[model samples]
Target chain A: MRTPLGKVRNHGAGAAGTGHFIAQRSTAIALAVLAPWFVVNSALSLKGGNYLGAIDFLTQPLNAVGVILLVLIAFYHMWLGMQEVILDYIHRPFTKVLLLLLNTFGLIAFGAGAVFAVLMVNFGA
Target chain B: MAGATRPQRPLSPHVQVWRWHVTMLTSILHRVTGVALYGAALGLALWLMAAAAGAEVFGPTHEFLLSPIGQVALYLIVAAVAYHLANGIRHLVFDSGAGLQPADASTSAWFAIFFAIAAPIGLWALVTFGG
Candidate 1:
């Protein structure tokens, strides 16, 4: 029995599965640590009361880096999570192919958008 | 007996029927937390796009975020963040082939429960003290 309190047992699921699970979890843990910072930074950002001011605040170390890292980690974790969902739900040959394609492209888009926004902030200032 | 026979419906692996266990609860909570966090991510995206695009968009998004509904949603999202994180570690142990025994399952499950609760409470305290 795979009980949490007893002496830990082996999952016997093999290295490939364990590796995927571990990676999904590792990114998720990073995201968990990062989430509050992003939320608080976001909530505080609205206080400045103007476009330029919001931009200005984001230029600050805490907000700028907070947002940049937030975007990367969030998207990475999400991509990993979504891939599992797609694998479970989409069983067709062609549709699964497309969904996999979409997941990869979507993550890339998210990363690019985040980088673009940060660059804009830095250069626009 | 035939006259009194009852039909049995297919059951999804839901809360009922199965004996409730900590690992099971934590597993369900992880999925719940994940979906909730997705919604939160959407809200974040809106706010980000607004901030990037300028005041015309930022004004409405900002107002919504500070509203009662928005705040509640924000709170749930953060709470889910905590749950998912803690539960995620439990999963990590399972992933690493370390916590598959029933006793270890219970122990790690409790550990996740405590960790999850601690984080959101910490966030709420931050909001109360600072916001």
Candidate 2:
């Protein structure tokens, strides 16, 4: 009974890196930079003490930029990071591809809705 | 007989047959919670953008969230947010190169559960009591 050389060899090379691991860390750094400013903006919103007061504060030049930045960064972060999670555990290839497309559309829809909202806030319509 | 016993297996049978571990549960739940949070986040993204945009867009969503079903959805989102946020901090800690030990892994898992549950309760109290 001879043991084959192939049997002695191992099979560990298939372990690979995915986009989620990298993107999550990348967006982690972005969130660290963005979160504090957002906290301050949130506090400011409360301070307005009334609807139009809140509206006026939101319409400020810097505040508008901050809100836009927050939406864009946050959605990008969520999309990329979540794409990673779906790919990892949901092993069926078709389901995985479907999820990827669903996620992409989801992000786009979110972006559109947000843009619409920003337009409403900025233009007061 | 003890020494002569059949050579023990190098690894446990069925990494599948292995006990459902805390670390494993935490790892999976972190990702699961992430998907839930993404839905909630889409809502938040709109809210922020609407805030930027003004009343026409903002009012309806604001009103929607305050409604009964919307409140329930909002509550779930709040729960997801609390768990994800706390678990995220745990990942950050691991990213920093701490908690590599087996004991540390289990400790962190417990911590994740504790924080996940506690944050929501705290938030629930504040939302109900503060308002």
Candidate 3:
């Protein structure tokens, strides 16, 4: 049943084995920088559960940009990681496909919503 | 392919079959914390959206985030992030084809666990008392 060419290339169904690997690693590297900065900065700025402080922090141009980048990259990374988990464990074809779809679209929607919110706060929309 | 005629396949050893080790734990916890962070990201989005909706919306959201239950959730998210960050770096090092030796790998795994526990407590103390 094996096509010699298919066996030789062996890229699996996606035909891009290394793409996921590279994307995950690159995002991990970016998060290594972004996550720590966001955590420490938020910890300092948002102490006392200061609601107004959080709004002010997000309104700053640099901080707003950082938050948007964090949400996008973090959501992308989450999608890739969840995709792996679902593929590895979920054996039913239908369930697997459904989950994979939800994982991608859900993260995109959430990420877009977050970015939109940040822009709103910054632009006073 | 559908019945007893189906060929039996050799199955890989799973968690229940393997003896526990720090490396095994770090590997599992990386995924676990990753899933936890997924929820945290959703919370982040909701919080931001609430903030953008003005104080009437954020007021209650912020209060919930500061409530006892919310603090517990935040603490756990902090812990998850800490562990995932530490172990993730270990994995990146592993990707580079270095530190794969059992001793070095386990050492890094332990360090990651330690940091995960300590970082949140340290952060809490700093925020609570370091005024």
Candidate 4:
């Protein structure tokens, strides 16, 4: 399976592959628990059209932390999943790499923005 | 990088070529739902930012969620989550080296489909009718 270029690279899909697999599954397990809580919390928060109350509910320490964890994990998991999809469907090499890079940057930017928002709300910033 | 003289490469069986089966359909839907969830995550991030920006921002965000289109979108997201979660658990089981047998795999695929639809609809009904 060694191409001359791969031989020059010297490492296979070893540790990185394991880490990727573990991350996907662990996030899956975490979301299985967190997603339900998220849906229910969102429903209760916004159901009555009390926007301030909804903000207040999210600002509560536990709920704030939960939303942060949920968004962070969800975004990371999303990047991994999208990577797989792009790799499968985007057969052209350069375009595929470009798309993958875009996916990574997009996820990081959004995840950071979300976590920041949660903190701002929590601290009244 | 040239295209005109590129050698013919063997292509794998795809939707147009393959006969459909439960596992095949489930596999495709899993990827579709995952992609859908990625878009949903962006909306979630924006919503969080809006809420953090105070009432002026949160008002429109809240109104959007209660709007008819938002309600429909929310319900679709709920269904997508349910299906993805159910299939993801099945994937984990397969990763553990169980459920790889044809019969078991088919059964689980069907189960995932059922659970995905039923869970979201059931929740929608409860939320709509209950307090």
Q: What's the TM-score of each model vs. the native?
A: 0.72, 0.68, 0.89, 0.87
User: Against the true structure, what is every candidate's RMSD?
Assistant: 9.1, 7.3, 5.5, 5.9
User: Across all candidates, what is each one's fraction of true contacts kept?
Assistant: 0.20, 0.48, 0.76, 0.70
What tens-digit string does per-residue lDDT give for candidate 1 at A4-120?
Answer: 533345644333566666677777778767875676665555543567777777778777777778888787787777777788788997999798788779667656766666666
> Comparing to the true complex, what docking class would candidate 1 get?
incorrect
A1-125, model 4: which lDDT tens digit per residue? 12466545875543466888899999999999998889877775566666678777777898999999999889889998999889889999899989999999998998898899889877776
Ranking by DockQ: 3, 4, 2, 1
In candidate 3, chain A reaches a TM of: 0.88
**Candidate 4, what DockQ?**
0.62
Residue-by-residue lDDT tens digits, candidate 1, B41-114: 65565566667777787778777766899777776776677677667767766766898999988988888788
- The positional error of residue B59 in candidate 2, measured at the CA in angstroms, is 4.2
Q: After superposition, which runs of candidate 2 have C-alpha atoms over 4 Å from their true positions?
A: A1-20, A32-57, A60-63, A89-95, A123-125, B1-16, B48-60, B124-131
lDDT of every model, 2 decimals: 0.71, 0.69, 0.90, 0.87
The TM-score that candidate 4 achieves is 0.87
Q: How well does candidate 2 score on lDDT at residue B4?
A: 81
Residue B5 accuracy (lDDT) in model 1: 81
What TM-score would chain A of each candidate receive against the reference chain A?
0.79, 0.70, 0.88, 0.85
Supply DockQ values for each candidate: 0.22, 0.32, 0.66, 0.62
DockQ for candidate 3, C-alpha atoms: 0.66
Maximum-lDDT candidate: 3
Estimate, for each residue in B1-131, the C-alpha lDDT of model 4 and write its tens digit.
Answer: 78998889977878688777899999989999999989998999999888888889888887888889988899899989889989999999999999999999999999999988898788877677877
lDDT of 3 at B28: 86
lDDT of 1 at B109: 85
Interface RMSD of each: 2.8, 4.4, 1.1, 1.3
TM-score (second chain) of model 2:
0.74
